[model samples]
Target: GDDDHEGEFGASSGGAFHEGEVAFDEVAQEADDDRDTISLVVVGHVDAGKSTLNGHLLYALGYVDQKVMHRNERDSKVMGKASFAFAWLMDGNSDERERGVTIDVGVNTFATEHRRIQLLDAPGHKDFVPNMISGAAQADAAVLVIDGSTGEFESGFHAGGQTIEHTVLVRSLGVQQLIVAVNKMDNVGYSQERFDEIKKEVGAFVKRAGYRAEDVSFVPVSGFKGENLLERKEEALNKWYCGPTLVELIDRLHPPVRAVDQSMRMVVGDVFKTQGLGLCVAGKLDAGAVRVGDSLVCRPGDVEAVVRSVDKHGKRRRHARAGDSVTLALNGDREELDNVRVGNVLCCPRNPIPMVCSFLAQILTFDIAVPLTIGFQGVMYWQSVNEPVVLNRLLCLVDKQSGEISRKRPRAIGSSSTAIVQVTCQRAVCLERFADYKQLGRFTLREGGSSVAA
Candidate 1:
């Protein structure tokens, strides 16, 4: 009778209900299929209005709850000035809220007219640079916010500016598309000349970092006023500007496409157990595809297991392709899960490689005050692990911009110096060629509890 609804729905009682159900199902399916999600990370120097920009973007997109805004406004009145309201949306911890700054990476999801965005807001202060690296490693693209009014770009000894260092770091992490937001336009009176100057400097720096100048988009806006972000307004300010708004640019930017390879490889990012799901490992599928019931060898650990299930976004899937953030459940005992923790590789049994104890890496220094020398102890961050490491030897000092070796075994590499060095970690860790896997290859060195660079 239900099947007959398609033939004569106007005749029978069950026919009308069946026809309505089918229509509802089709509409729901279309809605589910229409979604396009892109993951982006927002990063910049401290007090660059990163949190403010994130708040305004969400507010304009109708993603900010009205009650939250009301509470913020009421609190601002009590505090005697308008504090950062959007900071609350990202930094939920009370310590972060009281400090009025972000320390760790904060993730939030928002939907726009064009697509859905999973945004990672990273801390901008120098002290939290490690957290920034962690967030950028998982992002597809980045939004670098700069304060237009201060124009304080160069923090260390480099002539270009700190934004230059930030750009190079983001590029090294494999972020192809970049959106440069020159915030605090209201403080600068929305001057086209100022915006152009910052844009030019930043564009040149981006180019120097091995990124195409055309790949960078510049948007001048006042995050506090919510100007030139999601909506376009015809005003006396910024009359010379004619370009896509921040939200427009974000929607227009496409996700970074991964090149598929037949070789089987996957870098583990984290290991956890979900409710009702035991011993799940999450990470991007770097190459090849894995289906449920396929056998995989946990490299370095030398453990073997059958993929009981592949869960993605709460749905059990038959297989996972490259670039998918998948969770693979094991068909064996849970204790073996520790063997596949972050930094472990997943591959076939025949192609296992040993995790290296020491490696040579080209490193650039961020803090110039402290000279990087041989046997300098600092924290090393790669993938999700941050541990103490010693810089065993400075093989050669290289020029930052030219990429030419300046000296062999220099006594010390100062700020703005790039050098190739042999570094030994406190423990064995997995690392791939930077060209092969940028996510796992790149690392940040920290000294005196401050991040220098990768």
Candidate 2:
């Protein structure tokens, strides 16, 4: 009778389970089957209300409780007025709270009408630019927040001109869909003129960063007052606007699609071992697929191993697909697992290549004071790896809009200059061409102790 019932409706009734259990299992299975999880990172200049926007989105989705909000509001008194309730969600450390800024990346999740979103809130301060780079590297889309009232669209000389620099860096890191949130609208009376000015300046910067105008969305909102974030409010205050709310805009973003037929390549993020699971490597699958019985090689020494088991989000599965965070158990000694650190690529043994040494890279310089020349050392950030490398030669610096060399062997590249350079690393590494694999192609050059561009 159980087999007959299951066959009729495609529902499996595990033996010894009650009717209620069967129904619950069926509903849970359906929810798990939905493949619409999207990853987005919120980034902008410091004090741009990035964390506040994230808090509002979570509250609207019913994920953050009223008690937490109350506690945050009370804690705001101890902190500055600018940080109010936002500090709790973004300030994870005591120093960050005291400084009244976000220093590291904070990850939170919320459910929406069409899909589930994993929001990575990155730091906006200039000193914490490295953290922003790391968070942006893992994001599929990005939301750039700007302060409307402060009118701080461009960075001053003292701030290292970080506004345009950060924009260029985020775009080069492969964030396609960008949503520019002109925050603090309440401070400006939600004026249409102010919004337009910000929109125009940001639009110009986005174009200079090599992104099309159509791919960018501009919205006016106050993260502190929770305006234009989740729900619609019919008030004369913002009568001039009739666009989708921020949450709705986020819901409409399609996840970055990866080519399924590409060669098997997955960047290693972490290596862990469970009491019963032996050795496991955890990271998001960038392209292709991996099965339990598939054999792969970890570079730098040509270590080979066979996949003993695969687990995705705590469920044992036969295989894992692209964009899935998976952990693979191996059939070899766990000691060798340390070699597979973050930034290392896992590929087929027959197609093994050196994971280190020098390579030609197309670069963009965000610093004007420093000259990009031969024998100049700068920090290189690609994928999950960040290391110091030397600029071997100034190959050719070309302007993307005109496709011409602005300078040949130019000694210095001002802010927002694109170039193709030859860099030699102290160690071996792996990188994919920008046209082939955008994820591994671009890199950020940090000189003068700051991130220039990617």
Candidate 3:
């Protein structure tokens, strides 16, 4: 059961609403200039060391103290995977450890002198691409970890590679800064030729995926050995590489500008219940601010909940703003939790997300086995929600290269195609025009266990 108040949170733990509101406003405003938090998501192909790299980073930053590492080492050794000790830091699930693959998103936080990074470790296997997108959508920048081991890079970077899919997906989701970590260099004796070759191949594809070459950086690293992550190695170690370490490149990236002034809107990335706090929703505040006692609406259902409390980066806060990954505790009708799930929107009571049965979206097809035609059925993944949708009409065919309209009404869109179409989901969804909100606007269509369009 929920508390009696319909829209107002009963009382602040800090006492009077006046004092809480004043402190909340100050905290939200300070974030605008502080730039203290930067959300970074790691993406790449499977076996590319994404977990090990992030785990090593957590170690170098002192987040994984020696005692923790020792325990991880003892546990991994007992399981006959002593080498997996570093990776154990992020792959916390037992199933993931047994399969030796990341099955879910791993999230942790680390700090540097300039800013704090909300590190998101996405599973690299194509099977987990949906989970990867969930992680990517909430990121400010990304690091594509490439395998430097022999023949491994080719398989992950060539046609039909996770590299292409990952790069396209992240860019489509609005991540501009990309740091390509050419990891596992020690396996090839740290050869400069190998690093250059991998960099050149990756850079060409990244540029085609809509990222400027200037915004992308490449550095040689060995996550397994803890090289070039936090500090630069000596010439004797990585002789040909004289550039900054992984942390240096990350610290140099400025956090993206936030939509702090827009009406408060946050997509519920996860949901849970607490003993005394009632319902809690965690997500990035896509725009504006939320205080301790604001009224909010959950739609697609138009349910109501009062902001019970706010938390950011594991710290209890009086307020949260755009770009900050926050969790909101809500007290309202208990049944409201039934309608709210991952991918639901929580927004200002008066300006809730518009739920629509159908909408027109300009789409770029990646590699579909067949042409997308009317009445086609597939899953629509957006803002952490994966719901079924049907293509109702092919409004127009677009130029393959230029993206301009080439035909008024094409019958279908094929592999490597572009078109604008009317998409009608099986259920109503909170959606907006792509041009209006890039974060919430883009999505992917998957069918037959493969991504057909993004």
Q: Cα miss at 301, model 1 (Å)?
A: 4.9
User: Candidate 2 on 1-454: residue-level lDDT in tens?
Assistant: 0000011112111112233312322222212436566768888878777888888777767888799878887777755554558546656677777777888778776767786676888888888888888778877788988888754554421255456556767777777789988888888788888889888877886886667777899888888788899765637445899888898888888776653455566777678777766677876676666766666887756677667666765567766666666777766555676566766777656554346588887776664565566787878987667888987787777977787877787775566677877888888778776565567666788876577656
Off by over 4 Å in 2: 1-35, 65-83, 151-161, 234-236, 270-281, 300-317, 326-331, 338-340, 350-354, 399-417
Question: What lDDT does the true structure give each of the candidates?
Answer: 0.71, 0.71, 0.82
Give per-model CA RMSD.
10.9, 8.8, 6.4
* Candidate 1 residue-wise lDDT, 335-449, digit = tens: 7765667767787555443478899998877645778888888888775568788988889988655778889989988876678999998777767766555555678887775
Pairs that clash in candidate 1: none
Give the TM-score (vs. native) of candidate 1: 0.77
Candidate 3, residues 1-454, lDDT tens digits: the string is 0011112222211212444423433343223335467889999999899999999889988898899899999999999998889999999989999988898889998878788788999999988899998899888899999999999999998867798789888887778889999999889888889999999888888887778888999999999988889876645455667788899999998776666666678998889988856689998888778887777888778887778778887767777777788889886788767678888888887666778889998888876779899999999888678889999999998886676789988878898777889999877888866655567778888888777887
Better of 2 and 3 by lDDT: 3
- Per-model TM-score versus the true fold: 0.77, 0.82, 0.90
Instruction: Give residue 328's lDDT in candidate 2 (0 to 100).
Output: 79
Best by TM-score: 3
Off by over 4 Å in 1: 1-38, 65-82, 111-116, 150-165, 257-259, 262-272, 279-281, 296-316, 327-331, 338-354, 364-371, 396-418
Q: Which of candidates 1 and 2 reaches a greater TM-score? A: 2
